[model samples]
Target: MKKVINNPENVVNEMVEGFIAAFGNDYKKVHHTNGVVIKNKPNRVAVVTGGGSGHEPLFIGMVGEGLADGAAIGNVFAAPTPNTVLEVTKELDSGQGVLYVYGNYSGDVLNFDMAAELAELEDITTKTVLVNDDVASATKEHAFDRRGIAGDIFAIKIAGAAANDNLTLEEVARITQKAANHTRSIGVALSPSSIPSTGKYTFEIADDEIELGMGIHGEPGVKRTKLQTADELTANMLDYIFDDIELQENDEVCVLVNGLGSTTLMELFIVNRKVVEILNEKGISIYDTDVNSYCTTLEMAGVSITLMKLDDELKNYYDKPAYSPYYFKKGRG
Candidate 1:
């Protein structure tokens, strides 16, 4: 509870109000809900994404050019209410359609599905592509059941780019699903994040310990071990990713080195160095490497590596320029 805030109950509301006030020129608050939509009128299929709060620069900050059109937000580690999602869908749907891209969490799955059904009743075409990229959460036999972690942005980026190209909702969803399937991620948590509402740490680990395959929502990972070197930790993570996706020589990919809150950029770069070296040794072509704290868990000391296996079709959308305050890319379009 060492956070700089007034009341825990008002965290979500106050944070969102502050976000709208700061980014109002390009984004607007969705009426009567903790949601925000881009002010730009839609000329393409709308892309909407959201999940529990606490993962900053994610569902909310991700709404902008080349990203989501709107995002319905929920409280810390909670799902957005069905009504909140519905309002965002209503605002962004410009007769083209709407696509929902979000992490594959049970809460998100339940709420977004309900909202999609509600949208359909009103004749607003809607589709969903659940992001299931956390390789440690499930085995290949249960791949679809894996939890979505830092890899959500890959699916969001691809979905937004396809929608920006004026692809129909169905096409955009198809491409996004492909991206979600091709992407794989694994994380090592050196520590745990705290809950704003409860003012308690989600979980705890010893000072010299790390949890492999930790979920963003603080679910205990597949296994825990004493902390290891940067190279060893990253190599261990990459092994899980490679086993899941089976990357091969000459295969291209987008690498996202995501920080889970308290992990520093310096540390991330060290991890990225090892990642690049391994990729080179394996003959995997790195299409683009983004090392940043894009997806976070509120000062949790951890990092997750995401690799999106790409083909020509996926490359086309992925190479499109994306502009958001948090995630900006100057693609060679």
Candidate 2:
């Protein structure tokens, strides 16, 4: 219920404005659009990914040097309009094809598909890779039915690197899908995030409790229990993720500890400490690691851990240099 703003309805607009104001040197707003961000420098295969607005540094903060070339921002926790996606797609097309990558949500899927169809009519080829790495969202038998969450960063990074490598549109999309398939993520929410307009949390949780496997939008979790220690929570999260993707000894993986919104770096590192401890115990090699709030849910107090089991191809792309407003990695250390 507490927010700093002029009008609730104008939050998205002002957010876009503020983003452009600060990052105009690297990003430009699409003319006559609600929420479309285009990179100043074009890529061989334009990478586009977006979703609702509340998840900062996601659909927008990701548009830069080594990430998505463009992003179509949607309303808070809502899908961007088809027209918005179409416009960004069109602007991104520089003879090379465009790749649309976003989370797996009903509204997002529908709108992005529509935009792709519209772009095809103009001879602007487009491909899509829907991210569904939230292992807790579905059983292995229905993995594709799961919702996308922090795993999106892996998708975008691999796709953008492929595109930057001058790979063909189909190649970029293929590798991006491959990276997505190797990824798994799960989260725990200590508190709920509210919609600015409504000034209400989407769901309620007790002050001394947490929801395990909760989705970013306050979706029902596997269980709601009293708050546990950081190590306990991390172990529970890793267990859920490992149930879906087995990490064999000597298998190399990328570990990402993502803060939702209000979760601090100190907390994320604590989670990462446990993640590393568990991985080392299993003999899983850590190739690269990142701990930050690459994606967030509007001040939600939570963290999500993502693991991308890497093959040679995926590791190459994962180690590629990337520079975004919110994400920066100089290859792998």
lDDT of each: 0.91, 0.90
Top candidate (lDDT): 1
Question: For candidate 1, which ten residues in a row score worst on lDDT?
Answer: 324-333
lDDT of 2 by residue, 1-333 (tens): 689898999999999999899888777888777555555556488998989899998988888777888899789999999999998888888878999999999999999999999999999999999999998888899998999999999999999889988989999999999989999999989989989899999898889999988999888988899999999999998999888998899999999999999999999999999999999999999998999998799999999999999999998888888887689988863
Question: Which regions in candidate 2 have their CA more than 4 angstroms from the true location?
Answer: none
Candidate with maximal TM-score: 1
Model 1, 28-129: lDDT tens per residue? Answer: 888889989999756889999999999998989788888899999999889999999999999999999899999999999999999999999999999999
In model 1, the runs with Cα more than 4 Å from the true position are: none
TM-score to native of every candidate shown: 0.98, 0.98
